[model samples]
Target: MPRGSALSQSLIDTAHALADAARAETLAHFRNPGLDAANKAAAGFDPVTEGDRAAEAAMRAILAERRPGDGVFGEEYGITRGSSGLTWVLDPIDGTRGFLSGTPTWGVLIAACEGTRPVYGIIDQPFIGERFEGGLGVARYRGPQGEAPLRSRQGVALKDAILFSTFPEIGTAQEAARFREVSARARLTRFGMDCYAYGLLALGHVDLVIEAGLQRYDIAGPIAVIEAAGGIVTDWQGGPADEGGRILAAGSPELHAEALALLSGTAAEGAA
Candidate 1:
């Protein structure tokens, strides 16, 4: 349907319910998170924990019972067969390292992409007690029953900006150098943040999110929420969202292009 006017209300409700359940499960583990992280899939990569596995499993089960025809692509568990028209992308824990580091940037992430294009998105930070969702030209945030409109900060300069970046895990040396060079000139830099920083930006807390290396799961949910809040979400070269090489999220389009001009120069040098 590509997020038409006549979308499924049932699907939206299912997304909310799934997000709520994920929040509950993730919150329980957030308080008493025990470390049993194993490298199951990749070398030096932490596999799914009891919390992640349980949460994803629960979501999978619920979806199976309700929308049994929708396919799923989860970071922890991998792909499933169902909706070719609708795909559910899940990152059981977006910032597991942050989750383990006693930082609050860790959270649960999910998005319903209507055929590789995100139509509905949800970012649930259970520990901090915030939930952000965007779809169908409607983007807003909520804590409980009260929903409020979210607006991005306007008239912000790059040198006077706050950047939320996590480059150490995903970037190569060249990419890291470029990230550092650009971030060093920013007003302040916060690192190792995943979707949480984007959520904050959507809520008008931060200014920019610069990502050089990412998969579809990393910025999938944020793209919709941040844009819904009247911000810019794009690749490093300032293109579409899902192409996935580098990403720059900014509060305004002007700042986005400025920062992108600087970062893209770096990317060009690296290519040279």
Candidate 2:
């Protein structure tokens, strides 16, 4: 089936419910004095906590009951191939660094993909009671203030745009140099927001997010939300971000185009 064809309101509802259940498991470990974290990667800092495993396990159990035929690909536990073409991409705790340090910026990311294309995504920050959902021709935000439609800010210039990256040290030397080229031209640049920055972009608070060294689970949910909110998400070379590496998101197409030029090094520094 094509993207969005297999998706229904029922599936979306189930996605939200999965996030809710995962949130409970994650919260149980969040900030717990006894919570233990270990580095999963040998070279880089890839922290995995008991919370991450427990939360993903919780969601997988729910999926086994709720969507038995659907596949599951998760950050913590890896893939469970299913007969159904639709697959759930999950990151139980997107910002484990923030979660470990007691910051609420970390969120539960859930996305449903038809084959390889994502059709539905939800960024659930349970601690803050905020949920940003997109796909199915509508994007919405829910929080203490209540639910409202989401639309990205339009016609923002690159020089006046707000840029975010999970870290300045992402990717190789060449890639980092390319990122700095764009960051130098932006009006303001902030780092360490992780997936939260993408949610903010969908809400029109942040303008551009450039990051590298990401997995599919990291970008899937954010891409759905940003695109549904009238934004653009693509790789550094202007391609789909489905496989997740060196992704850039802009609140508007114009901003994206301008940034893409710099990221590709096709434009001179400070080019208007």
Candidate 3:
């Protein structure tokens, strides 16, 4: 339960291993001419490629062998419940659209949860060799360049912050309006980075990330990474984000409070 305990280290190592195994599987199918991409959404064009299935399957295999009693929840495959309180969450290719479009921003997400709380997480971008890992009291970035400690920016003002969202049309009418409210006040706003945006936030390159219509797998890994890096992550209403719809992450507590006030419409526009 305490930070940096033996159990935490073991879970972190397991997360890295799972991400490594998934990276291999996703790389094989990524951007291949023969890669089969199909729509998984009922009425819209939500894509699922062979890479997604293969990568998740690969990670599931490792979990089955190494943490046999742990539960597994993956995007491609359905849930495999385990008696152990730990549940491994997998999103083989987080930015599937980016991957299909040959963008290197896609990442493999792996997280270990004890009950409803995430204890460890890793965001692995194999193509670029960047791995952002965090849990309990530790967060770090590892890549071909080198490894370094991670910390969020301090004293960031809301009006001067950089913001990101996966897409503008992602959520309902109200959610879109809420996002617009925050984006309008930020110094700059960018779109289409997917989960990669969260990693950038944790690294202090970006200051805020607000998005809606997300599942648990989408934010669990990033939430752990961001929080461990000293950022705040919560639902738009400033509640727990573990269930994942309408989430907000900020580099500092002051910034987070400012964003939440705007998001909740408690602070009028142009209010200091």
The TM-score values for the models, in the order shown, are: 0.89, 0.96, 0.95
What is candidate 3's lDDT per residue for 25-128, written digit by digit as tens? Answer: 98998778777679998997789998999899889988888889999988889789999788888899999999999899999988888777787788889898
TM-score of 2: 0.96
How high is the CA lDDT of each candidate model?
Answer: 0.78, 0.91, 0.87
Q: Better model by TM-score, 1 or 2? A: 2
Pairs in clash, predicted candidate 2: none
- The digit string of per-residue lDDT tens for model 2 on 1-272 reads 64343557778878988998988999999989888789998897889999899999999999999899999999989999999888999999999999999899999999999887888899889788899999987699999999988888898998999999998797999999999989999999999988989999999999999999899999999989998999999999999999899999999999999999989877865555
Candidate with the greatest lDDT versus the true structure: 2
The weakest ten consecutive residues by lDDT in model 1 span 1-10
- What is the lDDT ranking, best to worst? 2, 3, 1
Candidate 3 TM-score to native: 0.95
Model 3, runs deviating above 4 Å? 1-4, 269-272
- Model 2 stretches with alpha carbons more than 4 Å out: 2-7, 269-272
The order of the candidates by TM-score, greatest first, is 2, 3, 1
lDDT of 1 by residue, 64-117 (tens): 988788999888788897745788888888887776666777877778887677
